[model samples]
Target: MKRFTLRTGIRWKITIAIAAVGALITLALSLVVHSAARVSMLESARETQLDRVQYISRNAEAGRKPPMGAKLNDPELPQELRDKARSGRRGTYVQEKPRGLPEVWAAVPLGNGQVLSLHSQFRESANMMRDLDRALAIGSLAVVIGGSALGVLIGGQISRRLRQAAAAAGKVALGDPDVRVRDAVGGVVRDETDDLARAVDAMADALQQRLEAERRVTADIAHELRTPVTGLLTAAELLPPGRPTELVRDRAQAMRVLVEDVLEVARLDSASERAELQDVALGEFVARRVSALMPEASVRIVADEIVSTDPRRLERILGNLLANAGRYGKPPVQVDVEGRVVRVRDHGPGFPEALLREGPSRFRTGSTDRAGVGHGLGLTIAEGQARVLGARLTFRNVAGPGGTDREGAAAGAVAVLWLPEHAPTTTGSFPVIGVP
Candidate 1:
């Protein structure tokens, strides 16, 4: 059997804690006040009994006796008080009953060998004490209830503000750079929560400004290099066909490819690229594109589905994935299309741990070869294009039969792309073909 418990949110927990503390303090104060009042009232009753006894003793000494209703010399006097009178010592004692008011007895000795007693019933004082106790009990209960209600109200307000700030932070984490906690939590009275919201807003602003600056610099650099790269390409193409000429042509072509890749990356970073979606059969599109770009790779269409997406961007994403598989992986690169999802699997040693963790970056290579690794812009451009089409791209290392590393671990790299079934299209599409 599972143990039962009371589960509560922060609001209730805070409210209960504050109310409990208030209740304890109120109870302590009430007890102290009640005790002090009881002591003072009891002392006053004792003094009144003492005064009555003194007056009766004086009258007896003047040869007069207490009046009939005074209860002086009553037969019901306690033995302790009677004995003190017989010994000629003045004394007082209290007499108690089970269900009624108590009586105070005072005794004194007469000069003629007789004892005198005086007593007073404490009916009025006992009733007053009972009423006082009732009031204290009711007042203590009221204080506890009122304090708890106030605590709940204050705690609810605080909890609501905190939840608003948390939601804004969640949106910020999900790439909504414009989300701000200040709008939700800001108020005229500045508090710690407001300070936290302001700090979050300031951090987001700084991050956005830095990113914009970096994008502008990248775009400007790419634009300046394009002219010189074009001239170099033309000169290399005009050279005579020879060993040295071939080397120059190849190097110039590589440089041109790099320049174009940089321009494409800059365009993506600046959000200048848009998708031009069209209704197309996904299976036929994948087959034709794979045949045209990577004829050596095997293609399998599991279940076809009509999807609305940018055909050119789709081709770029698939082409880059295929090229990376062929470059870094063994033969038999497999392309599988199921519904709106595509899976490209390469039976290689799998992606390096760093590449999987950090995604892709320009000019960073993960190939084991020390030389001739292409600038690492293929996956970077592919991922950026996927984002433009509102698609998701994920990479993982899967276990494959007979494919193992030197340590005898089976592994292969799998890149999966998921396109939305009904993607919205715009007027323009970004072309990423031949980008390095």
Candidate 2:
């Protein structure tokens, strides 16, 4: 089963933030401006209407007909303004009609139990406001859109530079010595992203230099030890046969193996090692190797698919695993081959916490309260060889009735080797077998 997630990139996040802020600001300003404009326009209309009502009052006092749009004691005048006129106080009101322009009214007392009132529908102010509202709305939208576009431009540059730095770091981790981060503006170093790029490039350079020095020292030590170790082996062989002679031979052999392992590590570190690929019956190959290493171990062939890989490297990996299990792990060791995968298990204390977490490191044997521990080169060599074969090697502890708890030793350790299925292979399948 697979799960998928929707990942929102930094560019979109920044754009949305900027657009939202811009929209809020624009809305606030639009409301303020519209309120101020409407108030100013209505106030001006009220002043003009008051002047007309005063003129009509003077005309009635002079015994002449009132002007158009003006009436003495009009029935349609708003009650609030009419009450103010009856109390001898001038008043003004703005009426919002359902259709047409808004009506502005002004009233004055005539002192004869009558009132002079004038009204006008201020169409110019209403139309001006309608036009202003349209302009503000369009302007607000444009601001938000423009801000979003600017945000994308800036955010995209940052995101792209970060992706480049991340990709370069990944290649460096995968043992690519020549990868370097490139800044957005080539050599400018303009911003934090540029700084990050420069920092990554510097780190990669330092790492490559350190690794080269380490490999040189390892190769030098191994080459220096080869001659004397070989001479010592020859001398031990020529000595008289006894318990003392056997001890000398064994120690000398161990030293020779150590030197050879160091040399192999140097080669793998140099990144120039190549695999010799050939088709192999996986089950038969594994069976033979297992028999040679630990005759008492069991082998189970489940799929037995023929695979293409380097036989020498494959055998080296398996041999190291078998030797490690037999030395430190309690047996009933088992090897299971299924398709392009091989799993080796030992019913012993599982690998130490450090080993499982950090994988194998040269000369660092993660031994606990177990029987014995090796020099730690075996698993390291095995892992390097798997890399050369383009395969994945992983370690785990199997849980079951026999498995140990945290306070106790683990039940068993399992090492899995997953071979590449896309490798070229020959035509036939190998027979499955369960050997005890």
Per-candidate alpha-carbon RMSD to the true structure: 7.9, 6.9
Q: Show model 1 residue runs off by greater than 4 Å.
A: 1-13, 30-181, 184-189, 299-303, 367-372, 399-410, 420-436
Which pairs in model 1 have colliding backbones? none
lDDT of 2 by residue, 1-436 (tens): 7899789989998999999999999999999999999999999999988987887798888888887878888999999999999999998999998887889999999868789999888899989999999999999999999999999987887777777778877877878666667632353447777777778778778888899999999999999999999999999999999999999999999999999999999998887777778989999999999998899999999989888898999999999999888887888999999999999999877887778899999988776644345578889999998887878999988775745555444688899999987552232122245689
Model 1: per-residue Cα lDDT over 1-436, one tens digit each? 9999988777888778977887898789878988898778767877777777778778878978576645556788899988888888888787887888778777777787777777778878878888988888888888878888887877777778889999998876545666799898755666788888999889888876897788788778878888988888788888888999889888888887887887788777766577977889999999999999999889999999998888999999999999899988777889999999999998777876667788888888775631158888888999989988978898888765654344324366889999965464563333444757
For every model shown, what is its TM-score relative to the native structure?
0.68, 0.82
The number of the candidate with the highest TM-score is 2
The total number of steric clashes, by the backbone 3 Å criterion, in model 1 comes to 0
Candidate 2: misplaced stretches above 4 Å?
1-7, 51-103, 109-114, 119-135, 183-190, 370-372, 402-405, 422-436
| lDDT top scorer | 2
Candidate 1 lowest-lDDT run of ten: 424-433
In angstroms, give how far residue 4 of model 1 lies from its true place: 19
